[model samples]
Target: MTRNKLRLAIIGAGPAGIYAADILLKSERHFDVSIDLFDHLPAPYGLVRYGVAPDHPRIKGIITALREVLDRGDIRIFGNVRFGEDLTLDDLKRHYNAVIFATGAVRDASLNIPGIDLEGSYGAADFVSWYDGHPDYPREWPLEAQSVAVIGNGNVALDVSRILAKHPEDLLPTEIPANVYEGLQRSPVTDVHVFGRRGPTSVKFTPLELRELGELRDVDMIVHDEDFDYDDAARAAVAGNKQVLVIDKVLQQWRQREVGSASRRLHLHFFAKPVEVVGDEHGQVAAFRWERTAPDGEGGVVGTGEIREIPVQALYRAVGYYGSPLPGIPFDKRLGVIPNHEGQVLIRDKESGKSRQMYGVYCTGWIKRGPVGLIGHTKSDAMETIKHVINDLGNWWRPESPSEESVVELLESRGIRWTDLDGWHRLDEHEQALGAAEERARIKVVPRDEMVSISRGEV
Candidate 1:
């Protein structure tokens, strides 16, 4: 690397971070550049590997494209390195010219309703992590419930309901871990009720995702015809959005289908808003109570006086994902995002009493904008952030030591065991070999210690 080379650090290896690196490398900049993509997990592809449902391999296929970007040899990968603990903003400033934070939202957003603290109440994010064999989550999940209630209308809510209703044997073909398979096998669930406040036309689910629910093996989907009674606002929305029209059509087809004798049943209930999660004597979830809702003629719904209660042992909330505050970032608590002006981080100056740009610091993905769109939306979000990054290149802070060797020395002096691209390839091969023995796609390594050990070549 030359003295004029710009050393960049991206603090996530997810879609957002990878896309940013790709754009930066492809940009026609005057100076040479070197990028280091960092992730806390030993593996890359953050959400695509840990957040997406395993059965949906099409969504997971995005990993192949991301893999090609890292394989281009212009970017370096630093896996299993935690920000704030392993390195700070000052540490990055000492080695890199600029830093981009792409750490995405992973925690479940709060709904702020009554009885939300009861036992047997789980967040869909945690459930997804467990089922997807995330190394950070617990290996065993309690699935002893016979009837479960899932609240939300997004693809995540549908994923939770479908996974609960689908048989364990049906998931064997996917890359589901052995522990998840065993945990789901013990589930006695026969009914999964999914509730949404809005009508079918206003649902957040993608048309393809919504249609996949109807094709699950041995699981019957039940949709009430009354739930499709849309108001003028919903009708107008469906008329304008082709996706909504397709969703409406698919839902209508399911509503007209004759009920089958499948052992497990998944009921989609619209026009219902959860009010409380009632608990039983043992402090576990006993029943779920919700109020009937009607369209408010504004693409929203208003709760009616009518209330309904259903007996259920477990409840999963999939309202949305919220970003966590980074150690040295200015975060907006209300929006669960880092405060920024067009991807340039904004900080209030103590002397001026006005918000000003934090030079050389940028944000992308859910941390820059709220978590709302699909994975494909991340590319455009990265482009916006990279535009600001390129604009600020003339004013970027020159590091005291910008060489790649300095970064390696810094991590080594701190005794941080970081994995590189070759390490990741070894772990990938290990997983594939494990999967080959089982005749599956790939068996995931569930334990964090094992992941670190494998990546570090200690096993």
Candidate 2:
């Protein structure tokens, strides 16, 4: 008796989704297994390719590991395939034994301030996408600001501030697209203000990210002298937690440095809670208003009722990233995640007043949990989801067409111009070729049609 093939479909070709596919294939199994990774874009590695900063090749190294998994011939990738639009829940149920929604968050979490809608105000996620050469975003960014405000203390805020303040010529060594390079080159930005709502010891920045701010050539690191007023709890955190200790040490070193007249300045402002974005007569961002905050004895901070405003032509809200809801999935709009219990997708049952697992459905990554934790933490998250997935194999979907050929036929029938693993290889080689000619690492292809055309050998 021959064992049956276990077919799986994963939405989102980001790190989380790629990890899930890799783990499942490597795991001990009772039957033969196969996976098909899907993404809306023609390329794979969703956020890793599109969300990361261009200058930080260190963080982007995760893609090499992800590439190894995709290179394996056992797994197939269907690119430029949108889940809800190209293939629905019904379509997935007809083909695969399991479906995992690993659609990580991309949209910026709402700031809900008085002047957040001003012309010069933007979401850091969008800026990241623009600079990373995402095909979907506009080619040109309005980098017309002289002074900018970044409202977050996380790694993302740091990335934005660094990119805005750093000389455009410095980014040329990386994979920065020509259009993005041109935009930054013309930017008149001199001061970049990074605001954290908590005290010095309570920032969300990693040790490496914080230290990198000071390393930017010709950019001065500015930390307000008063923001260092650490409370008893904050002081204890610095003495105890290893990460917090390193972060505090970096800030202290910056505070002691004598001020120099650098062409650009990157300011680190702690104990500042964003109150509003003040708009100018033309409804563009004129200034940023924030209230001073104090440590509230615990790990959190309380507003000090001291409002201050800074002159800034632009603002970026990097508070958080939120997930987009799928057509059939039950999403918690407030939390920006799918309702899941340890990776099993759940739906609220009106009669029982509780959530029950939606059979044959699961989730992992930022879509399952909120947008928190580092990329390394994603493997553990995938492991949790995979455990339930393997144990509950008996509960897998009974598909009408489980053969791999059926999915191809369905896609062709719908006229979906889906690119396979081979297509990704073509696109990858093309990017490298383009980069080699420019004497750089890799210049990313930005237009959607151009990427798809290259992948399909139509160009």
Error of 1 at 420 (Å): 0.8
Task: Give the Å shift of residue 162 in candidate 1.
Answer: 1.1
Q: How does model 2 score by TM-score?
A: 0.97
How much does candidate 1 score in TM-score? 0.97
In model 2, where do residues sit more than 4 Å from their true spots? Answer: 1-3
Give a tens-digit lDDT track for model 1, residues 1-459.
244677899999999999999998898777787899999998899999999998999999999999999888889999989999998888998899999999999999998888888999999999999999999888899998999999999999989888999898999989999999999999999999999988888788888888888998888888887887777898898899999989988988887787878898999999998899999889999999999999888988888899999999999999999999988888889999999988899988879889989899999999989988877779889888888887787768778888889989988999988998888888899998999998988998888778878988999
Prediction 2 global C-alpha lDDT: 0.91
Model 2 Cα displacement at 178 (Å)? 0.5
lDDT of 2 by residue, 1-459 (tens): 123677889999999999998888888877778798899999999888898899889888999998888887878999999999999999998898889999999999999989999999999999999999999899989998899999999999999999999999999989999999999999999999999998888888899988988999999999888877777898899889999999889988998887777999998888889999999899989999999988889989888899999999999999999999999999999999999999999999989889988988999999999999877778889988988888887788889888889999999999998888888899899988889998988999999988888888887
Worst 10 contiguous positions by lDDT, candidate 2: 1-10
Worst 10 residues of 1 by lDDT: 1-10
